[model samples]
Target: MKTKKLVMIPGPTPVVRSIQEQMGRETAAFGDPDFVRDFTSLLDDLKSLWKTTGEVFVVAGTGTLGMEMAVANSLRAGDRALVVSHGYFGDRFSELCSRRGIEVDVLASEWGRIVPLEQIERALASKNYQAITVTHVDTSTGVCAPVAEIGQLLRRFPDTLYIVDGVCATAAEPEYVDDMGIDILLTGSQKAFGVPPGLAILWAGPKALARRASLGTIPDYYIDFDKWLPIMHEPAKYFATPAVNLVWALKEAVRLIKEEGLENRYARHRRTARAMQAALEALGFRVLAEADHRAVTLSNLIYPSGADDAAFRRLLAEEGVMVAGGLAAYAGRMFRLGHMGNIDAHDLVATLAAIERAAVRSGIPVELGAGLAVLQRELVRAAG
Candidate 1:
């Protein structure tokens, strides 16, 4: 019998069968009546999902496009923006802004740790920035930023637009845009939305919309929020062709999320992450993220001294589990595992068992049942 493969990577997480079925249906025209209804409802449901009254844009692109849409429309070239970076993905904001001729200033924390709020306060005090970008969860280091506190802190600087990169956060994390004062929250469909890639979803608040209006006719055309605005107002209207089937899939994904209840979904992710993290530690694999500042969506785990990163991952794959390798400087030293979306305890139990088998097969000296034992107890504790 062949072992069933499970994609345990940081992104493009395992999509549930119901959501996957939506993607498999016959493709529909972007302007079809039913599609228009579904698209419009998805926009509305996303607003409710994030507790925002902002304009939501579901474009047919990658998460990077969502990031570009933020800086391209909101700020004119030569404007200054501040990037609060916890890891690589957070640091990417600086590059995105810089490419647009925006003067970018980055406050980057050491890998695996988050930048403190006081430092951000000091940065804001020193500069008159047009916008500030923070990654809610940096995919590379698995560090989760205190976005609510950061958003609360931004209230003092009313003129500065607050942009949050929620590519790896979004539905899995508590991102209440109106309450948190987030002007822009951007994410990709592949992560936590429990859908396949190719959609760039973003919610732009009134302030961000105003900022775009203030700086009308930005240089870029593709990601210009103004161009997307008319289409967003009426989903049946077209600017660029929308991903019709993906939109269908996303609507189904949202429906699943709604049925689960946002609070319960968040709690479930927390429990799952806690369980997996504790199990990894028990297996002698240290998490790259700081214990107090870990991301609930995923874990970036550092290898034990004697284990070969490639061999471990290969063995894990042989055991029918797939995960991603580290990026940038941390490459080959760690592996990333996603535990978000509509995953259950059984999935995680199997993953832990795979890891246990992989570790033992690789001569890592971990007791076969140790990680699984810890995972069960930690999950129960986290839940109770």
Candidate 2:
């Protein structure tokens, strides 16, 4: 019997059967009544997911577009923005700000760890930034930033907008956008949304909109909220051709999330990640992220001294399991395993088993069945 393949990357994660089936259906015309209804429903669902009653935009692009949209519409040239970076994505935010001619002040944290809340507080206390961007989960190192505290801290700087990159943490993490005082929360369809990668979903609170209103001109035309706001207000209107099939699939994905219940879904991801970490540690693989700072969506593991990263990953691939390589400075030194959206304990069991087999093949010692046993035990304990 042939073994089925599994994609365990952090992005473009495993899609549920229902969502995949929705994508295969006949595409709807842009102005079709059914399409408009579904599109409008998706926007509403996105607002609910973000826990914000503000404006939501579903752009036909990737998470990067969502990031840019937050910056482009809210901050004009010469505006000072503070970037809180823990990893590569954080650096990307600063780069995006630079491209727009916005002055950026970066308070970078050590990779694989959360940015210290005190550092953010100090930055805000000293500078009157117009906008502040933080990655809720930095994909590069699986580090979960303390967005809640950061959001609370931003209250002191009431004029500063809080932009959170939730690409990897959105539904996988417990995020209450309005409660946290987030001015903008952005995520992509491929990560925790359990859908395909064409949609950029973002919500902007009233403060962010007011800041945009104050701006003289926004250079980026396609991502300008002003152009898309009317279309969002009237679903029948068109700013640009939307991805109809993706929109349909997104609605189904949101329905599945709703059926699962957001709280339960977040707990499942946490359980899966905890089990994965326990099992990997039992296998002698050191985790790169600290215990408290780890993300429920993904885990970054440092390869053992004797193991060859390439060969180990290749072996896992041969066993029908796929994982992501490291990014930026940690490239080739570690590996990333995604446990978010549509992933379950059984999937992690299979993944850990594959890792055991791969480690043994890579000349790394591993007691037979050790990793799987730990994974099972951890999962059961988590469930209890």
Candidate 3:
């Protein structure tokens, strides 16, 4: 059983040893002074990472819970929500809202394309929504939404809370809470945060908090922001016992991110995505995303003509590399390769070689060394 394969999927990216060491520490009580201090610092660092002074919730849940929290806290049943969707996850937001008895209007585009700003404005003009949600980058399609532009458009609608699902984008993508006029930004730790999955982090700005306040007595209990507010302000007081180890791991992850500098890290992610996408192209695969809208955190590459999706992936796994299969309608037709979170040039080179080998073994036509040649050149250009 050969098991040292590279984990190249979009989430739970390779956790560096330092973060693992933090997670491996002895468990501490929620009220322990040391744990409280660490939790408090983690909250502050989260605010720093998102570039906002808003209140953030770090709870034991997945990104879905974060979405539920954002919805349950900010808007009520019968309220209207505008869901701007790029792909699968965007549609998930629509489902979340509709299940809450909220009237949902979805502005969706083709998998690889983003909804034009004019269409979003037209939708806004036609209806009055209490909350509008956008997926920063829909992993299913590898499409990055125009969040900053959407934020700018949202300025005109001050009453609508702007909620961004950063499950696949946070830490790797640009998500400025205050500057982007975002009311709630939710994400999971597994994706770009470079930590094992467990934490669901959500940032609530003043507007979001005020909205929650206005809804005196919400329906939910576990996912409500009201219950977590006091705990966030004073970690010593506990509403629920925190995920102590994952919190520590997240703190260390944030520390590494800070040390590398956000701008540098973001640039590195861009370079990684670029090199992978270029290599895949040289190997005769087409990127699922449009050129301008491709996600920097990951790439969804369409299989070349006559390529066998399962065989290639299986062979790639045998070659000590793993990648994600496409979601929803594109299943069996595309593969999603993650490039974010603690991955480096060597990992990229190994994955590239494995990809080419797997494709060749799967009986897919390819020029030998063609993909690696382009990948090496890109790496050198990035280095120099």
Candidate 4:
């Protein structure tokens, strides 16, 4: 039997078996009654997933398209948007806002640190912004922002819409979209949904819909919420051809999530992340984010002083496990491991074991089983 390479990248994480089986099914006709039912069921389940009473959209695109959809629908030229930037994805929100001619004020934090709530407050107080955008988890730096606190603060600015890029945090993280006063919560299907890449999922609250209705002329036709809203509500209605196969897969994915229970899924992600962190630390690897702000979905680890990123990652590949290299400032200097979506303790143990082997192959002296033993210990403790 051929060995299967373990995929541990952040966005396109491992796909669950059920979802993959659904994806393999023959493509259904767009207007077929059964297909419509399944697709609409997916949209309905999204509200439950995001924990929102608002409208949800599962469009055919990546997470970046979801971010653009939020920006294009909520703000127009001359409108002001305050973006809270902690890393790459946060900066992306600011860029999206700026491209639409929306005046953007960015309150940026150190790469590995979340933006302080007080700093966000001060920035909001400085201007009468129409919307505030934040990244729930910045994948680039493994930093989970203080979203709940920021959501609470948005209450003071009632008219301002709250937008969250949950591409890396949704489903895996504990998020209450309705309770957090989130006007728009957007994520991709690939991350915590345990599905393959190609769908942008989002929820829009009443305020955001009203804002869209108030726009003079929509800028982006494909991403315009107004265009997709009717189709989302009535899957039989056509705006653009929905990704039928991906929607079928999403239905299965959502079903699995419901079976697992959101709280249980969140706890599982946390436990697996803890195990990974413990094992990495045991091997003398330094994680980039501070302990308190580290994201549960992924870990950004700095290459040890004597380790080579290229050589280490190559050896890891030879061991039949795949991880990601860092992005932006940390690129080549660090690596990332994604522990979200269908991942469990055993996966971490295998990854750590591979790393231990890779360390030796890269000429870095590591006590055999140092990291693996720590991971197993942590997993046992977590299971209890």
Candidate 5:
């Protein structure tokens, strides 16, 4: 039997060997002066990456932790919020609002569809919402929302804080958040950051900070911005026992990103996504998202009629390639291909080839060379 290498499914995307080795170093005490310095530097790097002049908060928790913190600190009981829902994460935000006793007016779009800017404008015009929540990219359906347009609409409601979930959007596509005027942007390390799960980074603009200050009682002790901000600003004191190893890996990842420059990193992601989409379409699989709204990181492709989706995934795994099944409403109907995080044309070609083999093994007759040929054409176009 041949040894199998792991292909990332959705996220906790493949961490590079250099970063992994850094994470394995001997642990340092939380109070060590050097650790505090490194932690502070990481926070600075995070702000630079997000391209925000706001205070960046790093917490030892998952992406949802940042969402919860943003919600708790920004909204008091009886506060009204407008949540734009198009997929799983959007619905999750609505649920979070309900849990926190915040009154919510939800504007929902069909799955795999972008929320209309007109609807968002109407929602803002109709109510005095304290905040508005929108997911920059929906990981479930591979749909990228028009965040900039939404931001423009929010200008009508200038006092309403705009919160964006950039978990799948961050390093994959940074301009959408910063250029769009998102007031609060949050993301986790496991997705585009190429690191293990366990840290969440939140960027809060001045408005978000002001809202936090206005709320007299701290929303939650663990995630209170007031408590964490002073410590983050002080060079000598650290907030929580920082995740030393993960912080080391994050710093290296940010270093690589800075070295590559943001525009080039975004271009790489767009190129890889275009190649994958071209190949899959050539293979007779329909793309779940409309061309204009498709995300740069992952592409959701519908299974061919009469094909068994689960068996197709099993066959691919047997061939040493791993892809993910759809979630919730899309389950058994679609499979997602992730092309983010250090993936390039060569890696995409390999995955497409594996898919070709898997299709044949699953008894679906596929024309040889079609997928790869389409992929090559796109790659050539990208290079030009």
Candidate 6:
């Protein structure tokens, strides 16, 4: 007999049985009419989820591909691009800009800290940038940036197109893309969308599209937003063969999210994250983020002094529970527990129990009842 496995890591989270079955269905040709209808409907649902009236494009690639498309299409060589770096993904956007020969300026906050609105405004005032990039939520540090505030600041620079990497924010929270004044918004199926990696979704406002057209040079053939956007909007046809199975799974996942109501879905994620944080704090673990700026999808917990982070994770794995270790500068200092899509109160309680068991096995001097008691109280509050 095998014990059940629980996946509490951020991306590629646990999938429901119905969605899994949909993925296992026989693959259909990209040009088929039924597949085209499904694909169009998925795009419409994605637009609704993104809260954007702009044209939406779904690329057959990973989240990074979406970021690359935004960078490649929106900026010409030597164009000034400012990236607000708070965690690993923000750093990646800066790197992409640099690789593309764009003049990149990064206003970096310390890991686990949110980027300040004043700092962004100052950057805009001091430089004539062609585009601005910000991560709506940094998965590495579990911090949520002030996108709406930044949107207001960007209004001061009419020439700068606002680009947001919303990989962890989409579906896990409400993103009013049009109202937030985002010119280029990028996300993927892996994180809050609750599907496997390999599909990227981008919603581009008219300004970004016009900028791409003015460039004259053809963008990267595969990642070109111009090419992909038409195909995604037109009756389904292939620029290259798509990942049909992943498309099917994404369609089903979007259906599930809409059925639950977007606000209700966000509330569920918030409740679960709050419960997990309450439990961790009770167990004497310090949270890495400030309460006001912490992301509701995940929590980053600081390890105790003199504790071996790698060994603690190993101990947890032995008990059949898997959690994520920190990324970049945070490696060896903190652990991350994701409470995003499809995770609920029962799942969080089970995770806390597993953590207690792991703590005891590792001789970490934890109180078995403390974490659970805090979690139970939070669940009760959410129910009311």
RMSD of each: 1.2, 1.2, 1.0, 1.2, 1.6, 1.3
Q: Which candidate is the best by lDDT?
A: 3
Off by over 4 Å in 6: none
Q: Using TM-score as the measure, which candidate wins?
A: 3
Question: What C-alpha lDDT does candidate 6 achieve relative to the native structure?
Answer: 0.84
| lDDT, candidate 3, 187-234, per-residue tens | 999989899999999999999999999999998999988899899989
* Model 5 ranges off by over 4 Å: 176-179
Instruction: Put down candidate 6 lDDT per residue, 1-384, tens digits, no spaces.
Output: 655667887777778787888788999888899998998899888887777777788778888898998888899788999999888989998889998889999998888788788888988999899999998888898889888889888888989999999888888866778888899999988888778888988898878888888887664888887677678787476687778888899999989998998889988887787778888988878889888888888789987777678778898887767889988777988888877887666678888898888877776778997999999988888888
- Lowest lDDT 10-mer window, candidate 3? 45-54
Model 1: lDDT of residue 52 = 79
Candidate 1 contains a number of clashing pairs equal to 0
Model 6, position 373, has a per-residue lDDT of 95
> Model 4 scores what on Cα lDDT?
0.88
Better of 2 and 6 by lDDT: 2
Count of steric clashes across candidates, in order: 0, 0, 0, 0, 0, 0
Q: TM-score for each prediction?
A: 0.98, 0.97, 0.98, 0.97, 0.96, 0.97
lDDT of 2 by residue, 1-384 (tens): 676778888988988888999899998788999888888888888787767878999879999999999999888879999999989999999999998899999998888777688878888889789999999999898999888888888888999999999999998998888899999999899999889899998899988888888885777799988999999987899789998888888899889989999899998888788878888888888888888989999999988786788998998888878999998887888999988898776678888888889889878788869989988888778767
- Model 6, poorest ten-residue lDDT window? 229-238
Please provide, for model 4 over 114-157, each residue's C-alpha lDDT reduced to its tens digit, 9 standing for 90 to 100.
Answer: 77888888888888999999999998899998888889999999
lDDT of 1 by residue, 92-186 (tens): 88888887788999999999988899999999999899999999999999999999999999999999999999999988989999999999999
For residue 315, give model 3's deviation from the true position in Å. 0.7
Question: Which pairs of residues collide in model 2?
Answer: none
Candidate 4 differs from the real structure by a C-alpha RMSD in angstroms, to one decimal, of: 1.2
Tens digits of per-residue lDDT, candidate 5, 1-384, equal: 984645757677778887888699898876778877887888888777667777888778999998998898899878999999768998899999998889998988888888788888877888899999988888888899888888877777889999999888888875544557788988888888888888888888877888898998865898888888887786456567777798888878888788888789998888788778888888988888878889887888888888789899999898878888999988998888877776656667778888898888887678878899998888888889
Question: Model 4 has how many clashing residue pairs?
Answer: 0
**Stretches > 4 Å off in candidate 3:** 1-3
